[model samples]
Target chain A: MRLERRASVPPILYVAAPLAAVMVALAISGALIALAGASVPEAYRRMAIGAFGSRLAITETLTRATPLILTGLAAAVAFRARLWNIGAEGQFYIAALATAALGGAASAGGLLPGPLLIPFLMICGAAVGAMLLLAPLALRLRFGVDEVVVTLLLNFVVLLFVSMMIDGPLRDRMAFGWPQSVRVSPEAALPKLWQGTRLHVGLLVAVAMSVVVWIIQSRTAFGLEAKAAGFNPRAAAFAGVPIPKVLVGVACLSGGLAGLAGAIEVMGVKGYVTTDLSPGFGYAGIVVAMLAALNPIGVVAASLFVAATFVGVDGMSRALKVPSFIADVTVALSLLCVLVALTLVTYRIRR
Target chain B: MSETLDILASASLWAAVLRIATPLLFGVLGALLCERSGVLNLGIEGIMTFGAMIAWLTVFKTGDLWFGLAAALACGALFGLLHGGLTVVLGLSQHVAGLGVTLLGSSLSYYLYRLAIPVSGSPPTITPFQPLKIPLLSDIPLLGEALFSQTAPTYLAILLTLAVAYALAKTPLGLAIRLVGENPHAAEAQGLDPIRLRIGVVAFGSALMALGGAFLTTAAFNSFFPTMVQGRGWVCIALVVFASWMPLRALGGALLFAFFDAFQLRLQHVTGKAAPYQLFLMIPYLMSIAALVVFARRAKVPQALMQPYRRGER
Candidate 1:
């Protein structure tokens, strides 16, 4: 058998490939469910219901999807430029901490009026996130160091740094020694989008940012340059595109989006920062970005799907006695299958 | 300042350093072998997690430690095959596919562990490897107790480091592997199949990596827990660059890292409450990044590293 690259792929294959991959992934997970002595169909039914059956369920999934969408966009933008920003987790933490610190100060000192505090904190958070990522990007550009390893290692370092801070300087004294930051001032908290629900306006912000990123990637001159740079750096350089500038732009956008995710999560959901504020949101963002094929708009859909799976799996695990890790397994398997599916879309196997 | 010197003077501190280095030693060699074959096994973190779980579970159930290690090696190879299938055979992006493998391997480990063992206050434990003291060698004052009093796997790790260094430098098979990595087309010209060689090397290297994880469960600690691998695999990846893809230097790098880690742990105790212990925990990762900045420019990388090899494509 030989694999041959297709001359041209139909546009529909892009959509169809991911759908097929998800189905295949779910089937594989069903087999694992069966192995665990659970009815696969029943488990899936429970999952579906748990994620979308009730208003509360739907809202909960959407609430979880809020940060995921932003983080997914973070991964999407970086991966599009082949930047490989794997330290989204770290950026998310640092951003959240920064946002918390700012929000705390603004709330206590009336540093900013109530209406202006949210935007101010978010801008600062994004700046912090961008700076964190730029450090590694600069190292890579200057020393020929691999950003992948540096970004990954930074995740651990940042986590420990966050741990130290929350346990020391950022420690909320009223929480009986729990290592977490002081709650954001009430005036600084994000207003609820819907009454009597956990869902906040952050979901709206995430959706808006996805649209904004979509435009930047598809319509902007920088987007074209980034695409060229990623596709072939030598060709891009020959075309007189500043490769370094494009990468620096990509770094700031990617890191800023991730930082925004953290900032939103703090104001919208928890109103504070903790080391566990992100439940692998940064890593999941990579999976989401890949599953979306790195299309900014597609990230919104992919994140919702991922969020539903986690929310559904939570309920399913308690009911069926299956481990909740099944959600992670399902997501990870889908990523691998999608990579294959995308390959099949671009190439044909001939025997 | 004197306390720092006193901490280093203790024989147990040196012994702990060797113990900590054992797993990293196995890990770096495994990673080095794979990278030398032109594949980046980013799945090391998850693969190691699976290895830790499977080894401990095997020993816990079967009451045979060697069997547990064997089980881990086999499982690790299987995961390697999965990774090789994606990155080598399909010609997918190594970074993405490897990350997928990591996610799959780690979550699968946790899922299976939960299925086998019910939720409990603490995880179950097994009889870990005891220090196998050499008769005459272990009798020496400081060096003997530090080096010769390690467990069986620790000794194997040291021997394997030398073996890998020799094989990579001298053997015909090693030459073929390096040739494939440096120039697969040249290897193909010489009538060697690059794909098969890569898959084989990746599998063998991944098996060794599982042994590293097995050491963690069956030697360093008696029980398996989620997240216990704790980015050690990433550290090994960094050590590979620090080693400049050389086996002997990989050994030296792992030892140096282990020494820093062991030293920090002691320093944390000595300087209790003066600085947060988390600061000490951050040393190894920070040091890895610093080492990369220093060595990455000078490090000679395999030309075909992360490159997809097609049989006929130029």
Candidate 2:
């Protein structure tokens, strides 16, 4: 007569639920696509083609996915530890600014070797992100402050700081009055993965990081403690898990991944920092991580799928004159549908 | 120095502060109601956006601001129902559900706005609600003009805050709500339906939030733009914490936040290029964060807040 949690859910449900949820989202968004004056099948076809039809298309998709992968990992790592680190966006900004500042300063000084600058800036960016989350983590642990609000508010502060940095202190003097920072030196730029494509070594870095995350999540003692803390903090604490330490560590790693995403984007694609550098990649990461069920390896696949939708929708807009915002609607729809599906995965109606 | 004093002393600035405070007041009260009832509707931003768009579209089509307001309230109710269903009925994670609502509300609103108003050189504008000056009260002084010379919704918001405060303090219904929020099991044992109570409060609160959104278009700007809600809904969330979920305190919090907001706009004019306006803009948000840091530690949050009430689960 009431819903009850399944003692052991069928393995097939794990695979089937996401597929069904995606199909439902697609069916719904398909109707929207039709309303946008494009044939649903044709629009979807265009999307597929734009996303993975060619080497260039795929490279673009993966290029777009590079940041999503890192951000997704960021969310996955933190959410797995039950830390709602919504400040990934803010951390990304802080890291982007830090990397840009370092690169800009290094270039100005012309002291560091060009080859070493990339790694140096990347570390500095990641360090800044970790450092930023520490304050919020401390506040949350020590004073019971809500990290959600703190993190979300920090986004605005960091974004404004970025705007100020680009427009005032870091304004590119050589560029003809664009609201952008100076481009990083060529040696600092991420090397391309393939010739004649925007895809860069960042994808490889992302993949490597994904592997590292998978190993840490599945094989490490820290990961076990994090999982325990996430599931039941009080029980975990009683079981001798250091919940506070685990939370702080997870937050730092989560922030670091998001920070690395920002740094990679700057080095690989833009070579400079702009106000519109991220199109909500950090926010999108939450959806990616959720869709992956906080599985580290799953994050890579989830990132690619999300990136394809974004890039494909852009292409659809260009090809069909449909507003690319349909992508956002679809993503939002999918997130809700997926959550519903996830609920059905664990519990079921009983009679 | 005298010119600076003149600007700060202007009745117009005070009026601007009140004007800015209106939407925030509506949103804060809405958020307060929901949080008081043990549901954190993070969808406030989204609901407000949806309300503003629906209201703007309604007025644009029918040329009646009253109808637009009604439409906005209805839209809010629908979103509230959706959120309540997800968090209350379905027993989903409130955090995820609220975020989903936000994402859906904003994107759908954006999509609909695009469809409703085609992209053109300039965005379409409508006849916004004009300020109505109360005869004797508006003529009294700076404070009088700032308080009395306002739109209809602004007056409604203030009255609603007082009413909410009184209801929470005095009414049996309010007592039931507080009981369910503070301890649902006790209320359940008393034969009260926690789910229904939570849903009702959420729906009503969402309607007020929608009015707040509608205010942005109808009274504040008279035009709709993409992302125009611009984190005001988020500010309301922070203000609820700042106010400790008390309605009258919310009034003071909203106005205090609005004062900094209004001051920043004036400061931009005075300091223009001399000081970075972006940094000036950060002051309000930073202050909110600081307020949260100081106040939230001791703030009396509902004991059952963010916890889904499933019957028979002790």
Candidate 3:
């Protein structure tokens, strides 16, 4: 058998591919549900209901999707340029900590007025995240190092650094020796979109950012240059696209998006930083981006799918005694399946 | 200063270095073998995690440590097959596919563990491998106790290093693999199947990686826990660059890294409250980045590394 590239791909394949991938992933994970001695159909029914059943359930899923949307965009932006920023997890942690630190100090010292504090913390948080990624990117540019390994290794380093800060300088005194940072001031908390629900304005910000990113990617000159560099760096360089500057710009935007996820996550939900602040939100972002085929607008939909899977799986597991890790397995399977589906969209097998 | 010097003089410290180096020894060699054949297995982290879990589970169930190790190797080969099929046969993105494999392996391991074993205060344990003493070597001075008295897997890891180094340098098969990595067209012209060679090598290399994970549970620790593999798999990837894709140098790199790890652990104990323990934990990761900076420029990378091979395409 041989594979032949298609001259033109139908627009419908873009929509059909992810949907088909998710169906296949669910069918495969159904076996795991059966293995856990739960009825597969029943378990799936529970998952769907748990995700969308009540006002509370829908709000919780959206709240979960808020950080995922930002992180998904982070991965989408970086992966588009082929930057492979695996350190999003680390960037999330560091940015969250930075936001918390700024929020606490600003409130305690009366340093900034209430209305301005949130935006200030958000900007500072993103800057810190941007700088974190630039270190690895600089290494790649100067030394010709593969950014994949360097970015991955930095995740562990950043996590440890966060651990040290929460346990030492950032530790909350009144929390009875628990290793967590002091709470962000009320002034720094993001306003809730609906009263009596956990859903905050972060969801609105995430949805708006998705639209903004889509416009930047599809309608801007810089996006065209970035895509050109990604397609063929040698050709782009020969065309005077300035590959280094483009990569640096992509790195900042990608890192800033991830950092903003951390900042918003703290302000909107937890109100404090801990080692377990993110349940692999950074890693999940990669899967979300891939499932969306690295499209900025598609990332919002993909994040919602992932967040629902996770939130729904939690409720399903509680009801059926199935392991919650099935959510991770499902997400991972969809990523691999989507990769294959995307390949099929571009190429056909001939025997 | 004297307290720091005293750590270097202790026999136990040297022994700890070897113990810590054992898993890394397997991991670096596994990664090196795969990369030398033009396939980058970024799935090492998840592969190792699965290996650690499956081996411990096997031992816990059957009460046979060797069987547990065998189970881990078998499961690892299966994961490798999945990874190899994706990258080699399907011609997918190596980066994304490997990450998918990692996610699948780790989460599946956790799911299986939770399914098989009920949640409790602490995870179950098994009788791990005890250190074996080489008769006369164990009687010698500091070097004897540190080097000669180690678990069976530690010795196997060292011997495997020599075997890999020799096979790569002297064997025709190794030459074919290297040729495939450098220029598959040349290998194809010479009547070798680059596709099969890459798939086979990735599978075998991944088995070694699983054994490295097995070592963590069966020797380094007696119990299995989530995330225990930590970032050791990633550190091994860096060591591959540090070694410049040579087996003997890979061995040296693993030892050097483990020495830093062992020393920092000791330093943590010596300093007590003077510094935070997390800072010491950060040393190995920071050191890997520093090593990459130092050697990445000078290293000769495999020409076809990370490039997917199509039967007829250049």
Candidate 4:
């Protein structure tokens, strides 16, 4: 009998592979922890406790997860359409700036009520975010420019622009010369979900958005066209689907979601923009999107899991004195492992 | 207006341009080899970090600069091997594999550095490479000071660019590599192993990238820090496009970016609180985007770039 590669493997393998990949990633992280002179089991226990051991811990996890959910969705939506829009980080920065500028000005002016102000700022944030990708999108469609590098380079430009704003125009004179934007008006702030906890309505909004995305992706004709464009662009173009329009639309939606995250972050959490506000949330979003296999509902689960790692690892570092970067290593390893695992699930050995 | 003129007339400003361009030159050349071999090594950012850390750590330990450089080169080759295995052997997606390699390199370097070096107090320092004045050439006026008096790596970068330009145009090995990149099936039909050639080129290119990283620490700053590479690797990716995959053109692109970078740093001192220096910092990045928009239509990218080669597959 000759061995051959089968076209498809059992469906069970798809589910099992990611789970195995997670286990392998955790195991590798355990070794890293040991190298850092921490007891793996003790550190892990601390992490779990930090992530979900108490109501306060759970709230903190959700709080940390709010932006992640949005960014993850951003990557998923764009990547699903093969748009390669890696500038979510820059879009998030742009949105944060827009939110801070508009929210602070409107609130200080008492131009809108609290309920109205928050929604208005968020909408502006999303709009600005979408606008950020217009150049990259145009270049990609018109000139066949590689969106990946263009998007990546744009991240730096937007970040520097924000830094300039914070240092110059947006500086709060009342705050004694800090490199930060003016405080947003209390009216523009996102209301807390729980009065006693840091949890805010932003979490609810993120989850709601995920459901909306899931419906759009699974139930809409546009979603079908997006899937077709991504999997086989030539075929989609031959079939008369507006490939360019679909890509541009998906990029806008992705950028909008990411911008919403930045707005929520500023309005709900930071209340101002700082240079170090995001700890690579945009980059981590790629991992989250890939781990979820670009499924909107699965993005929710992936976001929460990644959020827990961030929260848990902070505690692990404090208790075990290990460097928190081990968490990043784990996430990266999981990405590589999942890719391999998924590839395995795509093929079977036939005799 | 007079201050601007003075800044332009200063010898140091031009020297700074040459200095700033040195590491970027190494990176652009490194990326050139990989892209020319039909691989997009987005891992350049992370691999550079590995080189920087290894070079700093090795030099800090042994007090030997060459040893540090060697260690960095080895680490870069190792990461390139990892990228090659994932993309060439396993037939994984180039974009994902490249990003994965980047994440792995960056995080691993950070973790290892934290473990090896203590966090408290000042970081260990080394006597960084000092500029060597060329005997007769240093006597020349403006150009000599900017070009002749330089660190070893700066000179090496120039030599390497010329050597690479020559190799790509003149050598049979270069032709074989180009053949594999352009049309692997055709290369295979000529009895050349496409996968092996791709892997070899990737490894060689990555080794050059690692050297560039080492130059950042050992020659430029004498100390390594996380994020010091600071998107230069990504800039090199853009430079590849800007140069249209030509080594000589990449040299010009690298210098153009370096000039803006050095000028930005100088402009910051004169224009303090008047203009946002951040805008000046954005010049190189913005120029790159502008360059892409202008030249992307004309740039002849390698035919098989970003595609995985598999035997007997259509």
Candidate 5:
């Protein structure tokens, strides 16, 4: 029997809770800054002013936030279906590799202009990612395999494969002994959104994907089916929901979006692929998705906050003598705190 | 023909393989015991790493390797306690909370390194554990030399594996641990606290994990690097799954993986083989995923795996 619990909290309060939790996280972080021997007030001001101080920083934050948004969406979608696609990091690499091939081939042929080639390459990239994801997804659906372990392990496989490519076949001949791919042709490069900034069409694509995802997640029949599957498989089965089918369906879509993020970064930000292109963006997406409580709208806001934490840390590093890893430590600590806090929103702490 | 003889005749390579396999064996066995108790300890890699880091750090400060080993064991046991507390007591999501512990341990270890090294603390090249010679067996040509000639921790790992296997299969408490894993509710109904059983198994597993890491810091790498693990934890996870939750099978799987790893290292120095190292490294990961896909259909996790049981629940 269900316990006599308090009534469910309002949606608005749930929406605002993450932000409120983030503020508390910041207060703790401020103390950390103080411990780092920096003035807390000045550090906070610098963090805010640094992220929005100029077009470049703002653009950088947006550009950084782009992948976070896609990865967040990817995570949100998969988790919504109760399929933990833990290998998004590897999927990101595979997808980026797919786009890199297109960027190289199309640019080499001089067949299409940069604007036209970019979208096609991005689509190709997404397709590669979806293809890789289908393996584990199919296994989970058809064979009842544990998606979590399969997906997580595949991440390393994909990562190593990508590293192999960069180190071997993709290694630039003219680069004088560096592990990097050939540069994408100017024709494949994304159009810059602002002058003197690395921001490009990738950020715009990320925003568009988020909006479409919101509509799909909240307004579509497929979305409802997915949620039903996650909340209670037995109930969904009783209701005749194709649980496995829906799980695979959502996994493919999630992997595709994650792949698109990888593709965009290749075509937009770093013209040539490097080993460090998407640094833990796959894993960070989990953090972002969880931080937002998997709300598409919340994802948008949460990623920016997460991004700001890093931008602020970089700012602090430059302004003060503290290392930037301090920012990473603080962010990780904040995430742990936020997770504990978020769980409380759903389940009351009895003890 | 002579090449095969050279490869086989060199006792050093076999010794190296066994040496490298020691840590992996420890990790896999540690994980094996925990899973037997129905607790999949995903934090083995991090716990192991932290144990190594702490062991090395302590050894360096105290100048006593045994004390350092004790500290490492303590560090590992604490993490196991945390995992047990969250999964068994508090009933938090095991997978996520275990992952959180990994992140926490990994991050803390790196931070401690940063605090200690200050960009200049001799990039983690500790004076690793020295080889311990088993008095009479050290005289054997190849087999005995390969197996017996190693660090104290390596010998300890082998003993622990044999002991753990026996305890889990033969002991009364082991039956209780198995009962908790297979059916925690039933075990509780039978008057055994599933939570305590889980905690015990996990703590025992974690202590072994710390020993694995200590082998690395004190004996393998001699110091901790930020990325020293480089996804070894994930490897451990794959090793367990590939073995289908069987301790004996896990031992085999882990040995195979260690063999692949050692083989890859050997090939790295051979002419025109550097590129293959990347591909070779993928073998274990690929095998694990494939095993998960291929065998997951038949394998069954403990009834209560990843599910937190509330006391006196409906």
Candidate 6:
């Protein structure tokens, strides 16, 4: 009833709201599990141990988290400039294709050593990815088009485009009509950082990019323009800031990072691109960015949280015989629950 | 010239057009109603799934196709009511609330469907409804055969387009929905409840959409599939924006999309030409992107399509 009690507040309430929402979501999910004739504690235990307990599991989780870290950053970057880039999955696939094509060429060139070749591949991947994203971003800013709808719709277009490539041009000659491209040479591969695991240099790149994003957003002038433009375009325009340029530039960075994610997955791990190289990483980026509340550092933490849920789904599915798809349901539920809870950051949550 | 004449000879191409347009027609007409009421029914995909599930379940249990179709629409109406209740009454954010409804319906449908037939070699499939051939027109040449020879809902979809076109342009109730969409406060001054109007419009729209889902399972495929709509609801959403909130225009957009899909399915059979298949597949999405690119800022969206409507206080 006391809606006017804004005079009394605590800073920690912002922190508490997210925590409370998670607890509430878990409780609701527990009720759902009960409806499904399952035990909540048993389910949680299965999910947690599956995600974080085993070394192999952690490695697998890292592999999953690698792309997320990049795509989340991709989302975070465009969102920083207020460009809604929702086609990262498409960007990722195309980037993967570019990276794979480069990898195929690089392996053929035995002249370049390991030190020079790896960076060369990554740069090519990033550049190709950036170029693809540039067109949409250009039209969006220059024409005053809403990037959200265009980028979202572009996702399907890119997927179909990739499908065409794999089906027609990229299909391996030796693989008996398979949809995957040729595997890259071992020399062109991203070296495994862990001896007995699939985890590699991509995870490090993700971590480094997080730091770079943090610096860019908090310290750089471009970042300041992004914040100004995002918070209020009219106000920023009144202050003589170039809103369109900032939006386009930010969208490129977003597309570039998404492209980079695709490249890394190809170069560091898969060594080749397939039709299903990306499994909705862009959509997951939406959830990650929203969970972070547009904070880059928050994105790092949010990506890990999402990674854990995906990992846990695998574990619970095996032990409890619950379908792995429940992971998606859980993530969706958590996102809504968390957003609703975040309302307390702005308004009072009266009993 | 003789080669060109040979290229033009095909009835299946027209058949493919009707087959593809059926669902888009059902979903887009439903979208037209909701947009007119200023409630952007973003959960059309999820509602379609719910409708398909219930309709299939009814058919599976009862074996009566008509009642099954009725049940599908009823499920859609029920969901539309819920969407109306949450956004129109509780004043929740429609995007998130609608998405929640979608996730809830889809997840629940998936889980329930799995429970009914668990761990099978293949997901259990249903026999699709029979096509209702027109009395005289089924035998007619290219135009008559393509337009009239389809499942009951295919004809129903065309009938729906006419009904929506007429209702939206000629009815007083349609004006009320429009008034609610454009300026709810002004509508209230005219002695109408914006909230009640929204509820009715959304429910009606949902029923119309649910029929689209039923059409998919019964008339098109003859069985249920998970995530079968595959973002078609969102396509319907794009159609609404692309059409700038007009019924006949929505039909045009729907048919264009259906033609793209049908054209793609046909492209795979050209004796060896493969590249165009990808281009064909990309058409609907490309059109959506092109539409938003060209008209997003200029398009006249319903004034309160996504804004939550609070009952009182300035």
In candidate 2, which residue pairs get closer than 3 Å at backbone N, Cα or C atoms, i.e. clash? none
DockQ per candidate? 0.90, 0.68, 0.87, 0.63, 0.46, 0.40
lDDT of 5 by residue, B1-314 (tens): 45444655667767787777787777887787788777777777678778878888898778888898899888899999978876666565566666667766776676565655557746746576788889889988887788778888778777776776677788898788778888878998999987777887898788888787888888877667776766666677666666766666776776677766665555555535536667877876776677666767677576666666667674
> Positional deviation of B203 in candidate 2, in angstroms?
1.9
Q: Which sections of candidate 2 miss by over 4 Å?
A: B1-4
Reported per model, the fraction of native interface contacts reproduced equals 0.90, 0.51, 0.88, 0.73, 0.45, 0.36
Q: Write the residue-wise lDDT of candidate 1 on B1-314 in tens digits.
A: 89988988899999999999999998899999999999999999998999999999999999999999999999999999998888888899999998999999899999999989989999889999999999999999999999999999999999999999999999999999999999999999999999999999999888888889999999999999999999999999999999999999998999999999999999988888999989899999999999999999999999999998888887
Q: Tens digits of per-residue lDDT for model 6 on A180-293?
A: 886666777888989889999889998898889889889988889998998888999999889877776787678888888988898887887777677667777766776676
Better of 2 and 3 by lDDT: 3
**Candidate 2, residue A13: lDDT:** 90
- Candidate 1 has an lDDT of 0.93
Each candidate's TM vs. the true structure? 0.99, 0.97, 0.99, 0.97, 0.92, 0.89
| Candidate with the larger TM-score of 3 and 5 | 3
Instruction: Give the Cα error of residue A210 in candidate 6, in Å.
Output: 2.4
Q: What is the lDDT of residue B302 in candidate 1?
A: 96
lDDT of 3 by residue, B1-314 (tens): 99989999999999999999999999999899999999999999999999999999999999999999999999889998999988988888889999999999899999999999989998888999999999999989999999999999999999999999999889999999899899988999999998899999999999999999999999999998889999999999999999999999998999899999999999999899999898899899999999999999999999999898887777
Looking at model 5 chain A, which ten-residue stretch has the lowest summed lDDT?
Answer: A1-10
Better model by lDDT, 3 or 4? 3
lDDT of 4 by residue, A94-131 (tens): 99998998888987788998888888999998888888
In candidate 2 the C-alpha lDDT for residue A108 amounts to: 78
* Candidates by lDDT, descending order: 1, 3, 2, 4, 5, 6
lDDT of each: 0.93, 0.88, 0.92, 0.87, 0.76, 0.76
* Global lDDT of model 6: 0.76
lDDT of 1 by residue, A201-285 (tens): 9999999999999899889999999999899999999999999999999999999999999999999999888888999999999
By DockQ rank, best first, the candidates go 1, 3, 2, 4, 5, 6
